[model samples]
Target: MTTSTPSTPSTMRAIASYRGLPVDDPDSLQDIEVPVPQLRPRDVLVRVRAVSVNPVDAKVRSGLAPTDEPRILGFDAAGVVEAVGPEVTTLAAGDEVWYAGDITRPGTNAEFHAVDERIVARKPVSLNWAEAAAMPLTTITAWETLFDRFALTADSTGTLLALGAAGGVGSILIQLAMELTGVRVLASAGRPESQAWVRQLGADGVVDHHDLVASAGEVASDGVDFLFSPHSKGNIEAFARIVRPFGHITAIDEPEGLDLLPLKSKSIAWHWELMFTRTTYQTADMAEQGKLLETVAGLVDDKRIRTTLTKTLPDFSAAGLREAHRLVESGRTTGKVVVTR
Candidate 1:
């Protein structure tokens, strides 16, 4: 038998199951030895060095959620490529890389993960495994929401309001909106710490989401040109109340229901930013994900965009995974939480 390297396992440990189940059931996570996946023509096998948890991971863990068998539960990751498929030309073995793996495949929680070349990108040279691990999901989601939904141009100039600017996507979203866009950026954070968090990210103004209509009106009487929400329901009317005529509102949260009619009077457009949709749908621009991630990595490398890792667990373990879930579920984290190799 071949010996396993310290960083590379011949058969690695992963949180998985023979049957689907919920993470809360205690039977949710099982340590098992599984063969490292062989790369397909367009695939890369990464020796996962670190990972971060997202809400979707927990949701997918429970049999309550639908997915193929023996599913792995992670999304954000930073790793070292140990092997590559023949057709892969962009990356080779030992490249440091990061990615938000497709929801269609096993996740990065494993010691070794096989992913599509189009979905992976070179990791930022400046960050350690844990810090780099904090980025992929939130960065991709935030970048797509601002540039894609808003169609924000380089020259676009207007006051932009970001709702819920303390969470994972919101934190990075605030930073990019302030640094990259010509728009004068404002953000909402209900508590003092949350308010201060956005300010450190360079928000020019802050409002409370508790009563966005009134709170935002104080900042922009005629309403801001853009309203971005990373929070949940009850903000649609507030968004409608404070968005300029013909403006745009983008939200990552899955609001139970929204009254689109409220935006009708102002001719305002509403955009739903779901980062998984493109991969889930196999869109024409699916490959754009790799390109965008590469761009984000360049920014991180230059310190233009910062790594958002707020918490780090020393190793990848079920207990560690559960703690990450608890923090996310609390909805109080300021940035990302990561678990490193």
Candidate 2:
């Protein structure tokens, strides 16, 4: 998520929050001078070329005042490495790289950032910064949701239901499932445009989340083998009814308390996949993130995975980030939004 230090000047221009509140408020985002980090042995200093907005950025901005430091925003970024610390062995200055920065750090909405080599990867050579920036966060989420949480085996002899199948994570998840696994993929899209969007992304079928079970029937009568909900609620009991016995359910959203009693009868397994969990907790698998990102980059290079960038803005200005935040919060965005510097 973060490196110990950086080999650079002491300061850089970055977006930060001095107050915690709604992102629309001018005070919630400000351009500020922050220390250019000094990289640790395993750290790399990146000169950021582009950054992208996600729901976590807004939530983080809202909780800004919780810390004494100015809370900077933006997670996904692509750029060129400017310097590396002594202990770093994987990369050197001038290599193109991309990463979804650690939630515990100052973020990527800056001219320079220091990140651990274990969490950074080579940017796909086929894509530009903006396009590359749109991927890391969503890709990490979707990949982990499928492989880590759902325990999807190599054979993929299963059916998968993807809720919120038109948003950033869903957009990428559908493609990964269809391309990498044999699992039949079903997605939920509330709008006609969204339905068409998911269908184009290689979903076997699209169902309206408004009537989840009915749509599932129209798509597949026997019920799915795995259910993924980016946003979930008490009504998720309906999903329990539709998933096959012993099937797994994975969610990224923080749903309020719900009764697990219903799922017990079916011997269902529930998993929560937070993309930052490994980095945040410093799990032994932290380096696995680097490995996964490299695999994703290869997929991009081979044309198996497409960049999800749908909206682009110029510069790392606070106004641009606010607009990107507004778009993500609106819940109508078809793919990732990037801000180029």
Candidate 3:
């Protein structure tokens, strides 16, 4: 329980949830007034400047049951800190920050939102509100998978395959692996434009996603050392084949009927990363997320890496937010879609 409500408004405008309607329905996402969230001991109130629409936003909105509560839907955000809770130490009012918020909490689709300081970090100085907003969720997933789960080092050498390389997470994963590690990534993108997009992001090679194993084989004859599987449902067996014996795979998608039997025989280790894991369970090392973000921020400022923002809506208008959602739902979008202030 923390005090300090004077600078905060009693209510804020936000985009409300779909009540289980399809994206085409104009009523699916609408403008609504919701009370500003209260802060916890370690919470910081962010005056959200921009938010990016992720696939989960569409999935959650479409699956959401009818509710009297306004379920705001967004995760990635970049904004200024308006207020801090009593126990907040790392951030303060007026400090700009960015974070992909916890899925368990009411989201960042609002004008104001509250998040734990441990998971929030200084916004990259090089990127604007929209560009900065485009990262966070994907960046966290990529950073955690490559550095934390796989324990990759700068001296590490091997061929890494990024399946679905044009999507948000894959887009960043390609850049991070190329910039931070000795391993070269063969980015898998089905479309020519997508292949070009990933290559522009510093990918060492690009493979067609339609024939993942065959395309990847052309690049890594002995199979790859690491596979970044953003969508692993129907491709588990293919992944096991592409990965060398005792190789590693990192997955972010939740696919039904997932079978990992193929990997068991090859001793391929599977690592799953969810950016919300830290904030949802309040892990002891949660602040490590902030530190990593800070590190990436430096890389961004140094121009060694870049933001994946490709589409931008001018403002927080409901129509714009819905359009962003529709674009993401279309499944053809490359990089990230952000609605900015």
TM-score, per-candidate, Cα-based: 0.92, 0.95, 0.97
TM-score of 3: 0.97
What tens digits encode model 2's per-residue C-alpha lDDT throughout 103-144?
Answer: 877789999988889999999999999999999999999999
Per-residue alpha-carbon lDDT of candidate 3 for residues 1-341, written as tens digits (9 for 90 to 100) = 46554778889999987488888788889899978888998999999999999998888989999987878889999999988899998998889999999989989989999999988999988899999999998999999989988899899998888888899998999889989999987899998899999989999888888988788888888999899887787888888888999999988888887889989988999988888888889888999888888889999999998999999999697788889989999999999999997
RMSD of 2: 2.5
Clash counts for the predictions, in order: 3, 6, 0
The runs of at least 3 residues in candidate 3 whose Cα sits more than 4 Å from the true structure, single-residue gaps closed, are 1-7
Best by lDDT: 3
* Candidate 1: worst-modelled 10 consecutive residues by lDDT: 1-10
Q: lDDT by residue for model 1 over 92-153, one digit each (tens)?
A: 88799999998877778888998888888999999999999898888888888889999886
Q: For candidate 3, what is the total of clashing residue pairs?
A: 0
lDDT of each: 0.81, 0.86, 0.90
| Top candidate by TM-score | 3
Name every residue pair that clashes in candidate 3: none
- lDDT order of candidates, top first: 3, 2, 1
The local distance difference test score of model 1 is 0.81
